[model samples]
Target: MPESATLPSATTKLEYLRKDLEDLRYYLDEFSAFLPL
Candidate 1:
């Protein structure tokens, strides 16, 4: 099997996942701010 077929695509997917997680955290924080403790 070729190495290029496996590695580069996974890195791209990881980067996308990280961005999505960051956005989710940001929204969660915003929602938390509106709630009474």
Candidate 2:
């Protein structure tokens, strides 16, 4: 309900999302290099 209380959870969620996106990009890059486009 309070903005202060919700900030940490939002930050943690963003961090997780960022890490997942980074991992996906890394794998995609590796896969793309082996495939012709």
Candidate 3:
């Protein structure tokens, strides 16, 4: 495979992973606030 193709695939995967992580963090924060004391 060409390096150009591989580079974009890697970048897209990284972008998706970062978005997933951010979403997870937001969910966790909301859950924490909802927990009882």
Against the reference, the lDDT scores of all candidates come to 0.94, 0.98, 0.95
Candidate 1 Cα misplacement greater than 4 A, ranges: none
Candidate that beats the other on lDDT, 2 or 3, i.e. the better one: 2
User: On residues 1-37, what C-alpha lDDT tens digit does candidate 2 reach at each position?
Assistant: 6999999999999999999999999999999999998
- The digit string of per-residue lDDT tens for model 1 on 1-37 reads 6788888899999999999999999999999999886
Q: What C-alpha lDDT, on a 0 to 100 scale, does residue 5 get in candidate 1?
A: 88
Pick out the ten consecutive residues of candidate 2 with the lowest summed lDDT. 1-10
Candidate 3 lDDT, tens digit per residue, 1-37? 6998799999999999999999999999999998985
Better of 1 and 3 by lDDT: 3
lDDT of 2: 0.98
| Residue ranges of candidate 3 with Cα displaced over 4 Å | none
The TM-score values for the models, in the order shown, are 0.78, 0.86, 0.83
Error of 1 at 19 (Å): 0.3
**Which numbered prediction scores highest in TM-score against the true structure?**
2
Clashes of each: 0, 0, 0
- Give the number of the best model, judged by lDDT: 2
